[model samples]
Target chain A: MKKYKCIVVKSQTYAKKAEKVLSHNGISSSVLHCKAGSVSGCGRCVKVEEKDVDRSVDILKKEGVILTGEIYGL
Target chain B: MDYKKTVYLDNAASSFPKPRSVIERMNRVLNENTANPGRSGHRLSLSASQIVFDARTVVADFFGISGHEENVVFTYNATYAINTVLRGLLRRGDHVIISDIEHNSVLRPLVAMKKDGISFDIAETFESDDLTVSSFSSHIRNNTKMIFVSHASNVSGAILPLKALGDLCKKNGILFCVDASQTAGHLPINIREMNISALCAPGHKSLMGPQGTGVIVISPELNTEISPLVYGGTGTDSLLDIQPYVLPEYLESGTLNTVGIAGLAEGIRFCMNEKNAISSKISSLFSYAYSELEKIPHIRLFSPKTDNVGIISFSVDGIDSEQITRFLDSEGICVRGGFHCSALFHKKALSDRFGLVRVSPGVFNTKKDIFTFIISIKRLKK
Candidate 1:
């Protein structure tokens, strides 16, 4: 099984919300404790498997999360 | 009359209808004396230096710091000031403790620094009323090198227990840094008494100053060796290859926003003279609006009843924050929507989906504005 890494950049205050969104969608993801460099300290990002990247992004966007950027491939 | 309309409720982001004195002073500086401050011994340069020095003095006095103009370093904005401290002070292996309601400006820098081996822990805010200082003590670790938190939240307008936190950090021998972006000019702050080692604030917000001007006040104790994040000609020690080992000149390397600083000086002067009146007016407005909003059963207010500034955050049941903001905008009302740069707080508060509509009233707002806003919100409920 190939594992794809998807970075979920968001506000740290929204970390639990993002986690919940991922879990509800059954997409296993881990919160990546890094700052979104481009936005001058906007929020936190999460990392998930590449296979679940599309679903995860859709879920987050559906939930109105502001995604700064994302990177794939673990 | 044009003055008879247009409600400006976004003061927490930046003030509107800036004092005429602020504009006049800025104009004076630009027209008569616009020179590189502290760069030359010429008369124009000396005059520019005097303007900066006077502004620094006003900032120092306003914040309750003793006369030490050199300790006040100017920056582009509060975010820049916070980044300077977080990057310069914290090193690998350092442990920092922050609060749950911090703005992204504080959170992001620390998050980035975590990659370099710095670890962070957050103190959970009390679920109910009263965010007391004792709540923060439990989160402090033996390895905690710094205790950083905001003086007041930009999102919810909840004032943190800075005095108590300052005492705890002082007793624990930890560096205490405060982000005063939301409360610097509107609320009273005493850096000396609070034991705040470094204080960061945006001059444009409550200070009624123009954008592009911010300040970082460093404690004299830490002034000896705080590294400069950016290094260049500081208009002093021109021959030295290294950054100046002084107070402000060390951190202030590039050309400053002189015009903005001049405006900020006047703004601070106006704030100082009208602090009590301005606070009372803002509080009255918030109190009236909070009471009215509480009556709207579907709306959940995030700011505490007491100890809140002029800002208020609330969510309308089943209505998207953007939609509500747009509706209010259509009524000629201004409000901020979305996560308000505090995504972590939104997650913790369970408001991540729609975020919250933040309405911050300034001194220029009136009773009619609040009444109209309430009517607009109530109409949305129906």
Candidate 2:
């Protein structure tokens, strides 16, 4: 199991769309139903590697995935 | 002796007892594929994303919204989908035309938009396609930007001449949008042949999906760009301060109900599998219910005499709609009472009162159910 960082969003739809954008671009990530809302407002989040956070977030934003907050996963 | 069994007749509202596949699919997603879609780079996330995409394809194809899957945008509900089209497409000073018997979903949005400088005219629905089309044509003006209508009336079970309206709009270069909340899963709607610009529907109703899921299928030829109603993290364009100007994202904002959508996809699949059987079943039931109800004296059928969807609205002589509904409720029959939430329909339906009892059947219903329902209504007359 690879340690991953999490980017959370309120909308499960956005979360799903964001995952597709990252995958289409060859980014490694997974969606989770964790308490990332403690960091972001949404309960749904996508997990990426900590080192890949900046790259993933940038691409997601550029692709128009609405994000709330990004946090390092435990 | 009256059997103690609950009969559901409010399929016009959120459908009851969603197909087994719908529930199973939803549970599988929640338990196994619980990844936050699209935002992830992991396998689970990607698979989850696939689920959402597949759902879009299912809905898009279901309505004949061809070309791309992204053209089908999901919303919170049909009302939200309608608002996305109304609030997004219509600008200030734009005018709209609609059928007289529209659900509150259309009327309420137009009302809210009125203050913003947009106006609307209501076209009376007629038995003849030419008459209905002319009724809408008579309201067309230089400023008329769109013709919006419910594909089938929730109150009257009246099916609109959507194909005719679509043709009229194409000839005039005006946009045509339909609220298919009542008909999406029940009947076939091909966006291309109909020349419709947008078709909005709820996943919960005819789609046989869960509540809180809806979709707006856009035609590829549509030139006008509609804005989204809600805004937040799209997961793709996280860094952009403005919402993404893309196919689905352009109209969608914030987190969506993925579980609901997963359920909706299965619901649509269930409908597709049983399409012929379901349609014929509804047709048979409608005809039977209509003929049976007509035989009972004092029952006034408000629905048009022509072919209709499963929805049937009527009032009994000297009996309040709610009172009749209550009597039926006590007999283990469930039907909608009151105005069904459309003030305009109510105004046209019962000027003396605010509501009518509506008996809407679903694919799951049996002929016996309608028979029991008729017996309950006959009891009211006695």
Candidate 3:
């Protein structure tokens, strides 16, 4: 039972686009409250399992989603 | 080492590389006089009010409105100016006639007021050919209290025939309001000759001024009293809690964008000084781009083939406008995509997709930039 939290940096519009890209790749994830330490404000963040983090990042990058910084572990 | 340069082709949205004078004047205003315009009798306040008055004169002269500094009311933006006129004038059971190419700024407010019993009709534009004034005259009804139209299409850069439509409005005795958001600085607009009762313009776009600066030029004939959108202190009627019943002070409540107004005055001066040169340059660029774009297969152009302001809208086959824009962005070419706030016009034009790629050049743009753009589009085709 591993849990991983992914921080989505960017606008809600971009976050929604990222969510669709992840779902299209058959990845399951839940968005969490956006934490600061990035570009300020609650833009959006996604929480996923520790193991699936690497695969999700790869998919997002390939789909042209700009990821600023990511936080691991909830 | 030259850095990765970015080319701005979004002048229609708002101009970039504003004239040196515009920037200089704005900086001067910020440093010197930052007081509330027309509020106090002190030197700083008087200086600030003078700057705003200068801007008012520039607008009045540019638009051919007959008035002193009092008639030009400062607004937040063209949208606010339009909302002021539409909401202020239109009453229950009154009707308005507008063009299909109106921006959401005009349409949204009118639509919201529709619930209050105001009705409106849209005149269809000739998408295949040039839209003429005759097409507009047919839509006017006896109940039509006002006729509003955009001077140019934000989506296609198609210039409307304002003078002809103005004549028609004059003959029928309908109050004409023009939204000059896309054409005010780039094109020559004479409010009197056009029979425009109210002219609304944004200083940020073609005027090359800072944002939050807008103007509403009221004609002499329009006697209808317009209530202030936001009532507070107009500096004129300090004693009365009610908004003052005057020319500009009636509508302009609270502090104005003085720094932006200073910049606008410079921008307008630059426009007047280099009117022919700038317009010819923009016209040539449009022609060049249109000819170059026509050579590329599967690229559908939305703008007319004739010369116009530095604006163009087109679409590539089987490619989404957003994706093309992204590709262009990667190449350091800036362009605008999506509906361009004219969904109704898009629907009427039946543009293959819901949106089009808009390329609007500015005074700073050169032939080399347009050449690079054409080359980029050609490469994208391959």
Candidate 4:
């Protein structure tokens, strides 16, 4: 069983941007389609390693990415 | 006849001899990745989607809408972008204001919207920025919802006062929309600095991109209010049965022109790298052409002496404007003639009968080309 954390964003655009920001901040991340009823409302979300969740959120926040929901485990 | 010998001066219509990077980028994309962006999760689709996102970022940065790249919506051309902004933003009984020098793209949509109870008034532009701003201010009504004007005239090459107009709109609480067809790459436009709500421009003009690519950059405040002009699938929220409320995907429907956008991105990059030089080079060429054309006997120059966006509008004393252009074409010197699809401008300038010949030089053009154009027009005097 793989453990990962996801940060939901408004759309794929933000997801991709967040991915870039995280990569620049030394965090490895990938964008994934959010499941229905996710905080993003079926848009795309950025998934990252569970260890890098807090740092990734902080990086995206500092970069002004509108984070909709909390970090949820998947 | 060797094609290289011919000079291209119709850049205001569409830039010719696109930047080599733009061409090479488009070719590379078409050869490598033709997948629809954001339509699939596969590697190729993701690559295509990244290309679009990269282009959107470049466009946003170019227009000073950085960090809000999602607000940059891809359309087919400035016409479609203008239609989307005009139709989507204005509702019944909403009065809009436009400049007299608008292309048919802005004029026709507002004309059609009249049937839907939306009305628009044209504010006359003048050589003086103060008078031009005052004219636009005078047309503002209580019901005025938006003030849409061209950043520069396509006919007379008259550059409008965008900052003052943007300030006027801000003071009046009216949305400012600009048609940047003639000045996108030729001028520096910052959406935030200009207080622009919607900025529309084609990629093929000063941006030096291929045809079939344009952008509609929206302010964040108008994101939710401006509805999608075209609705279909955005690859997200598929099961919802309604268009998803996303930033770009909200306004952007259908598959985007990936190859053209890739080319557009490279084009914008080229503009960014040459930003310091593009304006000065084009200005020098415009000055040279203006001085040389003013020297031609029987030539009537319509373009302003200064503050032009690299276009020279002129007419001959006896011959028709189209006839002059036709003659120039025979000499392998390309230039646009006649109304230039700007009847209102011609009517206002009182040149509707003879139209006007427009010689718009691009960044690729040289003083020698303008000299060739001058000598060709000189031949017409004989």
Candidate 5:
């Protein structure tokens, strides 16, 4: 059981690019299975710690990646 | 495998005996993940995708391309990278300017595109910074879209005034593209400082990577959308039939050279770690070789005595270059002969008929290796 929030992306490309931006910002994340009720072309999503959720979303948005949903308490 | 004993001076062609870590990394990638990167979400596929992204990020940081690691597009060689920029960005009726001494990689593509209603002009270098700048500036027109020049001539190892030209391009509002195949890992090139719009380089030469790895560091400011050179699966925008309009994914289509890029990342790491000291040592060795070769008679040296990258091109007066190359081959000294793949430069060097023997020393080459090469040249003069 993971206690982090999720950033659902349409594909692995956006997910990876988001991960790159987040990693450069000193936020650690893991590529885990996408959350339930997520619409994605790819199977994976990035899981970031709950405290860093807002910053992660901001970074992803800055990089032009669209976040479909944010699932909590995974 | 033991290139330490062989006098390998043909680094400009393709580097021999890549770093052990490069080979090991490639082997690991080939064994661990052969899946298509960014296309699938499986663990192995994601791992392969990460290596590709890592190579891009490493290249961007190494070249001082700010914040847009996604703009670093990987290709099979510098030739492909150069062609991508030339063809992708140029439009009909556009005029492109190129330096007089450019590799066939840049020249051939422009020549081929002439059929598409594009034209080009050549800017001659006079060994003076102001004169060279004027040469390029004089050719700029309203339709002039870009300026493409090699950072250093592969045929002569003469460095171009890149920063001055970059400034000129900036003032003129034209995209400045540099073919860095000869100087990428050899010289310190900060794309931001140079105001370069695009920098294309091969991973095999001074970058210490294996063949089949090349990169293009593009500026985010260029108006050119850079239509995809090869379009297939970008892994993003999967439902859309059209190609993605992003930075790397747009240009990078089809399956990437995952194993080669894996090795290339380590190669860039090695270069980064060994930057200033390694460049100094290479320059010292080149100076030694240049001086020693100058002592030989009936030789026409085309490169500068100092201030040159590891490459040096020269010809023995009245002696065919092929004969010298064959003799050197027998001497176990690996150097390239005949044209060195730059006919324009060979013509300017006045050795088109006779060709030129190009000696591109690698960082791994030693003073003893250069001494042996000079002695061999001396023997051939007899």
Candidate 6:
């Protein structure tokens, strides 16, 4: 079983954007629904392999994608 | 109705015969799936969400929004977008500056907001860029928070100095907004380059998209300041009692017109493919029409000779503009008549007595169409 890390974002818009930017940077990511109580307002997060988490987040942040919460293992 | 026989000169209102891609894309969306975007996590819903996101990207790139694609908020039309910015960003004590030639969309909302303690001043527009900038400068007050103006007059097609106005706003530390009702897609506009804090435009007009589609692109500086005019379920924030503070979803509350937005993306792509050729064609047609229309004895042209957006407003010495429009309609020529929902422009032009006849040429129009329109107008009785 391959574990993944979820990066919570502001909304679905940002999740999708982050997913696109990460893909462009050769890091594959998928958008998933954030579980209850994981985030306060936005309920969407971009999921990536645990190994690719740091690179994916750096790409998203540099591209102006707003990440709402800390990364959590899923 | 023989469609091909009639010439359409009302492109400024709502462009006819949208790009085949727009129609095809819209039909494809309607036929395939009409699922709501940003809702369920199912395949159909995700596809719909992708379609809307793609549109936001295209619109954002087209308007120089750069990386902040979520800043694009879809609405019903330019009026709705303008109202959103006007009502969303403006507070009770904040004053706004608008141009004298603004459409009723901008004027009426500011007037209505007056009762709410918000105030606005009208800046006179002149043919010279210096005089126009000076006029806007003279109207700026200590409380002037935003300067909202149309990129061009919908009636006279007079193009305003957007870059100059943007610079003035930057100097004054005021937020700048544009109502690109007539100039969007027809003219080149970069929100970043123009220092525009917010831009409002209808996708149906120069954008060549289906009706019921419009966009308001906000800069990062003014994003949180603008409150949502309509608030409801935003998919992600449904668990909360109040609306989400996130962008786009924050402003877009109801179900979006997925099909319209799908077509709007194609429409913007069509404009991008056509490039400067579109403006060139409109300018050529306008010049031809102006040269011919001025030849008529009683015709008085109101549009600027140069730097116009392909719109020509004219009137006979003694005949009502609507009467001439009716005559042209009888000749199978289509044009707009009356006040054009611009009371200030009409009042300023002193054509309020009977209004002016307006003909706006689009990229699809030709010199022959202008000649036909000119011939039809020449046949009118004074």
Number of the top-ranking candidate, with DockQ as the measure: 6
> Candidate 3 DockQ score?
0.01
User: What overall lDDT, based on C-alpha atoms, would model 5 receive against the true structure?
Assistant: 0.83
| Full candidate order by TM-score, most accurate first | 6, 4, 5, 2, 1, 3
- Which candidate wins on lDDT? 6
TM-score of chain B of 6: 0.98
Candidate 4 colliding pairs: none
lDDT of 1 by residue, B1-382 (tens): 3634667788888888899899999888889988876555456765676688778878888888755566688998999999988887887788999988999998998888878999998887763434556667777787888989998888889888888889999999899999999998888888888899999999999988999999998886664356778988676435456664555767888887889999998999999999889999999999999999999988999888888877889998888999999888877888899998997789888999988999999887889999999999988888
Candidate 4 docks with a DockQ of: 0.44
The reply for model 1, stretches above 4 Å from the true place, is A1-74, B1-4, B127-132
What shift in Å separates residue B230 of candidate 4 from its native position after superposition? Answer: 0.5
Please identify which of the two predictions, 1 or 5, would achieve the higher DockQ against the true structure.
5
lDDT of 4 by residue, B79-178 (tens): 9999999998899999999999999999999999999999999998888899999999899999999999999999878899999999999999999999
Worst 10 residues of 6 chain B by lDDT: B219-228
Query: Cα lDDT for residue B145, model 5?
Result: 94
DockQ of each: 0.01, 0.08, 0.01, 0.44, 0.35, 0.56
Chain B TM-score against the true chain B, candidate 1: 0.96
Candidate 6 residue lDDT tens string, B1-382: 8898999999989998688899999999999989988887777887898899999999989998866778999999999999999999899899999999999999999999999999999999999999999999999999999999999999999999999999999999999999999999988999988999999999999999999999999976664478989989888866679787878888898899999999989999999999789978988899899898888887899999998988999989988889888999999888999999999999999999989999998888888888888877776753
Q: Considering only N, C-alpha and C atoms within 3 Å, which residue pairs clash in candidate 6?
A: none
RMSD of each: 21.3, 6.5, 22.4, 2.0, 2.6, 1.5
Listed per prediction, chain B TM-scores read 0.96, 0.96, 0.96, 0.98, 0.97, 0.98
lDDT to native, each model:
0.80, 0.82, 0.79, 0.88, 0.83, 0.90
TM-score of 2: 0.83
Error of 4 at A53 (Å): 2.6
Runs of candidate 2 exceeding 4 Å displacement: A1-74, B1-4, B351-354
- Candidate 5 CAPRI classification by DockQ: acceptable
Q: What is the Å distance of residue B371 in model 4 from its true position?
A: 1.5
What is the per-residue lDDT of model 2 for residues B1-382, given as tens digits with 9 covering 90 to 100?
4433778889998788689899999998888877776565567776766788889868877878633576789888999999989999999999999888898889998998899999999988787879999999999999999999999988888888889899999999999999998999887899999998999999999899998899999997898999888877666545457776666866766656778889998999999999999999988888899999989887788887676878888888777888888899888988998888788777865533736889888988899999999888887787
